[model samples]
Target: MKRGLLFPTTLLLLLLLGTIHAQPTPDPLDGGDYAQVYARAQAGGDAVTASRAAAAMTEYRAGGRDWTARAVQAARQATTTRPGDPDAQLALGSALGLQARAGGYTLGALNTAQQARAALDRALSLAPDRPDIQAVLAEWHAGAWAKAGIFSGGNQDRARTLATAAARRAPDTLFVQAHAGIALSLIHDSQARATLTRAATLNADTPLERDLQTQAKRVLEGLKP
Candidate 1:
């Protein structure tokens, strides 16, 4: 009887250990990594990046429910965590702008873009000769100008100017080239093709760089006669 009881107890312990080991680890987002949260959200499906990016871009106007809210929260956290980091501020601004745009409020989108512009401006002020900062700022300005809706004050001339400046400042940067392509495409100029081609030739590894390159290609393709 004692031997039988010992065997059963040992079996139960072995089963419990197996169960514990078999349990799958939770995603990083669930464990409090916001960057991983964004990554997981992006990896969700079909390059969605998040439900908002997938849904809101539809032709029939899909509503952005909590997507904007989450984006805002993430942005705030990033900005707060590193007050002196321009990259953090840029991420915050980008998140806010994306959320606002997807939410479909022109004023809100413009405001968010402006906030991003301000952060970029501050970054430039702090490090005037920083190539990366200049490159990003140029992209932001060009994108802001190009994407301005009819209700917003979008000046094509200004957009072109900014894009040109960005290209000049960071001629080798993929994002700057992409932004220049977008701006030129908006103006229906032949230069867009060259810019887009140049952007594609560069190695874009980061999500942000990939996004810019993809956008540039799309814009360039759309402009083809």
Candidate 2:
């Protein structure tokens, strides 16, 4: 896809920030104020729920204010409870990235920007062999580059590289392929169209996978000639 055919930065921000909102039917897991429950799950010392919820929160890239804060809290708690788990780190990094994007130019955005990068760097280091981690990190880099540019540690080339690597590693995984396509399309990679097409054809086994497919299809539409 040509750079000129891409949407302007403002529009790109809206989409990448997940404001497009043209989602499919509400899934059981995504509906309601589940974020609150997820946030409070760890408060009673339920480390298992905290870990699972943190991973769940990382699935959806964006959300409303209170929901996002709660999700971030859940992820943070997960990290505190399971510091050795790469999933916990991925959750923290990915959620912080969303918080930063939603923060716009706020002072806290700067804080989250740094924390997000550090958290994701740690995640990849902890589990370099995991394609799921690679895909999530790919989206983080793409979004960081789009929102904060190179100064904030967002490298388009790195995003593309990780996305491609993830696709190669987990070609059958729904989120992996979808995120790979999303990251590639964000950087205007030539293979984005094919990757997204592959994602669109995948059988989404979970609500989150269905949601990811929706994002993939949306980006595929945008990338079409």
Task: Please report the candidate that would top lDDT against the real structure.
Answer: 2
lDDT of 1 at 12: 99
Candidate 2 backbone clash number = 0
Q: Give the per-residue lDDT of model 2 (tens digit) for 1-225.
A: 566656586677888668546665543344323455465665676543553454455445444666566557777877887888887788788778777877897778978978987888898999998988888788888877877687667899999989999999998887799989998888888988989999999998766677778878988999958
Error of 1 at 155 (Å): 5.1
Model 1's lDDT to the true fold? 0.58
Q: Candidate 1 lDDT, tens digit per residue, 1-225?
A: 999899999999999999999997642322323344455666553122342232223211232535555555554554566567665555555555555455454676677667766766766676666655555555555555556544344455655665666677777888578756766676665667887788877887555556556777777777757
TM-score of candidate 2 against the unseen true structure: 0.75
TM-score of each: 0.57, 0.75
Each candidate's number of clashing pairs is 1, 0
Candidate 2's C-alpha runs over 4 A off are: 1-63
